[model samples]
Target: GLSLEPILLALCEWGQHHADELNEMDRLADCIIRPRQARQPAIA
Candidate 1:
């Protein structure tokens, strides 16, 4: 059987390199959406 270790390792490396940028974008999205969401009424 072929091993997936190499594929996973490459993905991990890619994520590590972009982690900061990814986190920053997530933070920005939360900041932007949360406040706006708070002002809106939720539909049940």
Candidate 2:
């Protein structure tokens, strides 16, 4: 209950602190994935 609140809050704060880095990672992942997705032909 209350015990987990502090840990969750801390985790949220940590995530916020690394938001930029996380966003960059997300962008890089998308960049890598998109080309691979595009290269694959869709089945009819």
Candidate 3:
């Protein structure tokens, strides 16, 4: 498997340099993981 420590470290550095972009990326990831309709109960 590939080592992620270096990649994560780089991401942290980048995030520090570009906080706003990182925040936007986090928001986009949240949207992707939890769409609006996901909050509703499924109708069986």
Candidate that scores best on TM-score: 2
Model 3 over residues 1-44: C-alpha lDDT tens digits? 13555676677666655756556655332211222333668799
Pairing residues by index, what is the TM-score of model 2? 0.43
Q: Distance from true position, residue 44, model 1, in Å?
A: 62
The per-prediction CA RMSD against the true structure, in angstroms, equals: 14.1, 13.5, 10.5
What is candidate 2's lDDT per residue for 1-44, written digit by digit as tens?
55566676676666655766667535332211111223568799
Give the winner by TM-score: 2 or 3. 2
With a 3 Å backbone cut-off (N, CA, C), the pairs that clash in candidate 1 are none
Off by over 4 Å in 1: 21-44
Q: All candidates' TM-scores?
A: 0.39, 0.43, 0.38
Write one digit per residue (lDDT tens) for candidate 1, span 1-44. Answer: 13555675676666555766667534332211111223567799
RMSD of 1: 14.1
**Each candidate's lDDT (Cα)?**
0.49, 0.51, 0.51
- Judged by whole-model lDDT over C-alpha atoms, candidate 3 comes out at 0.51
User: Could you tell me how far off, in angstroms, the CA of residue 17 lies in candidate 1 after the best superposition?
Assistant: 0.4
Q: Give the worst 10-residue stretch by lDDT in candidate 1.
A: 28-37
In order of TM-score, best first, we have 2, 1, 3
